[model samples]
Target: MTAKPPPDPAAPPRSPWPGSAATAPARPPEVTARRLVARSRIFRVEAMDLIFSNGAQRTFERILGGRDSVMVVPVLGAETLLLIREYAAGTDDYQLGFPKGIVDPGEDILTAAGRELREEVGYAARRLCDLQRVTLAPGYIQHGTRLVLAQDLYPSPAPGDEPEPLEVVPWPLTDLDGLLARPDFTEARSIAALFLARRYLQQAHQAPAADGKGRSAPGNASSPSPDETR
Candidate 1:
């Protein structure tokens, strides 16, 4: 008839600590502090390094330093994606990834994106989406890599004065699963870029019907919806 004392208040109000709410102890301070003792570069490869910071050693790869740059994912046709393989002397392995390079001191990321697209794939994009900005490696590197999604492309003249022997390869979309599953698809920046690009492309291709025939305004158009299928 007394409602069983309201079932002892249903587990009691949480005191944010393991003590009686009426006399609970104060909570500990949140973790919001860190110190950078020092940082030194022990080894420097092109755009990368083996760095030691605050007694912690890590690989610092500068996809883009304080400067601006771009990474272009070129989707050719509906079934193939264009990629580049450049012989990386440091690792002595062919690094296959979206075309990416430094921003040449004063250029913006978007401009550099277009330039890298042309240089690596001999193509230009009529429309490119800014997918996201991400750090190459936050624990060590002081730089970030910008991921861009490119489409509506056309062949441009070869970057007449090529600097490196870049092999432009057309990989079938169906093979993307295999490429990612391979043991060597392991570079941080490239991995991040490919995943972001793949996610964006998949969503774009499978996008639901729009209410109208005309394409949505540029900013209003979908910008790489997260991988719902996954």
Candidate 2:
């Protein structure tokens, strides 16, 4: 089961994602030199010189990034998933995906998620669950994005730096197949977040409910979550 019996708060979670029979291979090549080749308003490109274990030398260019990002799966109620249709400069077109942004220098992922949700979707979540961490262009880039599952939404809007108002689309979670079928919904991070969040929610909803004294009981009925009182 994805959700194991609840453990001590001091103890970390144990139910890691299932693993494959094939273990990870040997360590990567050693970097010999790294030099910044280019810099733009938002990105920095670096040239890297590396020598493989077999003593083969190769040079490669990679985007240099340091800030961690948060992409939130904002669920309105139990079945609706909130997405934003924003103009993507990289593609020069409107793309559909979850509300996301870079974490500020001093901000935590949860805080950044709340800010992005309010700015992009006009909602704030009372419960923010950290589903997993994902990477972008691992072969060429060094940045990680946090996948967050946002629930218990409430109406709250904040100002954003977008040049245009983003279109908010609440799609039924059941039509995830349809969402994936669309040509515009093509962000890898967003797609991964959707699948991960679905698995997490399904596991959580089906897991045994905990009693008043923190004892788990076998049942389909869910106890009052934080959102229930709101």
Q: Which number leads on lDDT?
A: 2
Residues 1-230 of candidate 1: C-alpha lDDT, one tens digit per residue: 11122233457666556553554323322223333444456422222223222234343333224554577777776667788887776788887777887776777767778888887788988777777777765655566667777777899845634566688878887786887876655677777777777766666555555556533433122533343223
Model 2 lDDT per residue over 85-185, tens place: 99998999999999999999999888999999999999998888777788988989889999888898999999999999999999999998999999999
Which predicted model would earn the best TM-score? Answer: 2
Candidate 1: regions farther than 4 A off = 1-64, 158-163, 210-230
Q: Among all windows of ten consecutive residues in candidate 1, which has the lowest summed lDDT? A: 44-53
TM-score of each: 0.63, 0.81
lDDT of 1 at 75: 79
Clashing pairs in 2: none
CA-lDDT, candidates in order: 0.64, 0.83
Predicted structure 2, TM vs. truth = 0.81
